[model samples]
Target: MAKRKWLRGLALLLLVALLVVGGMYLYGSSSGTVPPATVDFAKLSPEQEKTLYARGEQVFRAGDCAACHSSPQTGAELAGGVPMVTPMGTLYGTNISPSKQHGIGNWTADDLYRAIASGVAPSRKLLYPAMPYTSYHQVTRGDVDALWVWLMKQPAVEVANRANAMQFPFDVRPAVALWNAVERPAAKPFDASTDALSRGKYLVDVMGHCAECHSPRTLTFALDKSRYLEGSIIEGAYAPAITPAALSGRGWTRDDLVRFFRTGLSPQGVMTFRMASVLDHSTSHMPEEDLRAMAAYLTQDQAMPGPKPKAPQGEVNVKGEAIYVGLCAGCHGVQGQGQPQSSVPLNTNTTAMFPTPINLIRVTREGLQERDLPHGGRMQSMPGFADKLSDQDMADLVNYLRQTWGGQPGDVTPAQVADLVKTIEHGDQ
Candidate 1:
């Protein structure tokens, strides 16, 4: 009698657990409130179509869609082969071109809206958070309608999406519903109400999605809202803090911010790492007024303390100074004043000023390629020193830069550099 009662209790417990799991899956698999589509596609006149096409192009540029979706080999804007690395695994951007076989050509505007705003694609496919739907949760439906018209009009590419390389547990696509139930925000439209500041917030937070990289992530890989835009290490590089105070402390002005977006160069520094793609695809193409508004939002339209040389933080290392003179002083002067359009000035450069030395180390070891920037800006090639420098040598050189120009302590060690090297190499893989 006792054994039969125990088995019955065990079965009941299993049934209860199954019921809870099933209920959670049902709730998570469903999308939150998606706003109604603003335009009637069938009834639009020629003039309306023209207006939507222009607005959609603007929306696409603002979203920086090409940076991820464009083909690195062919430079096809929506062919979608770029790889995004994360802690869980690598996810390739999907083909968004207008091909019915491989792209979204058959998707109605409402389908596009559901995908963008609620993170639910057709057939209830849940997109990985790498798509930035969290930040885009508040995007306006009107902008999406315009984007749909423009996207559908573009030439279709027949490229199929590359399979994701997610490790076990994450490889199960349906399991994403659990993450969604816990972390995803409800979709809502942003109110941009004709105010510059409001519009700037809309552009930066909703469309630009800057916080997706700049903000630190929780253990679950969701963005930590408490420290929004305070800086974080991602893909082996540090995305620096862009809070108004942080920007002002690093000698950024509103005009300089506009200049950086417009040209990818300012006294602050040149765009590097993932931001290089951003410059090529998005900011450089943005309008002057929009750029101004972004800058205004970043700086809160406040008067800022301009670039000034930082005082040396500690005793300079003799070996580090020698390395700088021997290798670096040719382009960057002995005093760190860079040549015109060739290299950025180091004294006022913000890389070393960051809380972590990861970017400085990464850039030094990897180097930057020569490139023609948009809007009359250009930078010569900077050579990588990976083969030439030992771990100790890199630590010393980075320490020297931090002390002399960054107003930071010379505290990096060879062991720390070796660990960072592993991280950099892994990210490259």
Candidate 2:
């Protein structure tokens, strides 16, 4: 009886797998109704071409592509050697350089556009969503063409591609096609509106893709609309909620936003982790008018009212202090000041001031990977400790750090700790 039951269960699982695979095969094979050759760059005028080139440069910075594609030690922009971690496994960014043998030297403008907009390669394999087509889809076609031109103009190097570290079921590319068919939204133009707020909304949603971090996602990696802009885990960092309610803890003002975007620092503290990388490579290079608009938009948005509850000054208990001493003191020092050579100062980290503890916990769990900085700078890498500490330990350690070093007494419940762990493990809040 037991053998019969096991066989039946196994059969059911196989059947479901077959159905999913078959659906993906059909979807990917048939749904690509358009040809790559349809990309018509001929329609662009000389002036339009120049504008597209400029916008493409902006998009490259905005997306922080160089940070991934470039090697930090060699200072090779877009030459590619960064390894990205995912639940499926680790995948390395490929050389987008125009090296004839190893990179996209032979790829046409259409190939580039399809790769960006549809996550489809020239050979029709679906790229992993880790490539962030969800955000790239908002990029205009003209901009993509210009980017292609710019990329081609760069010095090409023949750096070999690294093998992917994905698990068995996920190592396969066809599965992503299935995932896309079920979960991916088709690229569409930003909805036009008369008001500045409405326009800002479109930019943030489609072009900026702010929600990619600020919002949570389901187990299948679909955005959870219920808690839009409520913050989530991405790439080992907790992207905090940028909603009106969450910004109160940061004490952000209109001017602060503009300054932070322009210089990667605010009155609260300096940007670190992914946010700092974004500013140094992307936002700071954007037009001043756009920066002002983004700032104005954030200021107008409402935040949750009232003072956020934090650990009172010097109220960290002995237990919390012990956790920091035992685990953190070696790297962070006795006073929570990080090693200036390799670590960020915990006392003044912008991440320590977030309303929630996800960012703090996430960074502690997963050490950072070094990436490129604009103007020939490089950020230091840190190790992640997701598997090392328990929820109580994390809460205690973080509470101690925030109070002792971060000025604010940010209290984190065990429940919050558990929730953040779950979010990081699942790759979303």
Report lDDT (Cα) of residue 140, candidate 2.
58
Which candidate has the highest lDDT of all?
1
What's the TM-score of each model vs. the native? 0.94, 0.72
Residue 42 miss distance in model 2 (angstroms): 5.5
Worst window of 10 by summed lDDT in candidate 2:
30-39
* Cα deviation of 282, candidate 1, in Å: 0.7
Task: For residues 1-429, write the lDDT of model 1, one tens digit per residue.
Answer: 999999998997776566546534765545777677788889999999999999999999999999989998898999998999987899999899999999898898888888888788887788888989899999999999999999999999999889999885466676667777778888888877887788889889999999999999998989999998999888889899999999998999988999999899999999998999999999998999999889889889888998888899989977888898888989988988888989899999999899889999999998999999998878899999999999999998999888999999999999999999988878832
- lDDT measured at residue 399 in model 1 versus the true structure, 0 to 100: 90
Number of the top TM-score candidate? 1
Clash list (residue pairs), candidate 1? none
Name the 10 consecutive residues with the lowest summed lDDT in model 1: 20-29
- Please give the CA lDDT of all the candidate structures: 0.89, 0.67
* lDDT tens per residue, model 2, 1-429: 999999998997786687557746755552333234323566867776677667677767655676567765575777787777766778787888989887889888878877876778776667787777776666556556668867876788778877788886677666577677777667543445566576455456655667776788888877788998888767656677776645755556666676667765444444565576567656778776666666556556654232223334676657778876776778767765666445555554557666566777877787667754443444466677777778887888788767765555747877889977786676532
Q: How displaced is residue 21 in candidate 2, in Å?
A: 5.4
- lDDT of candidate model 2 versus the reference: 0.67
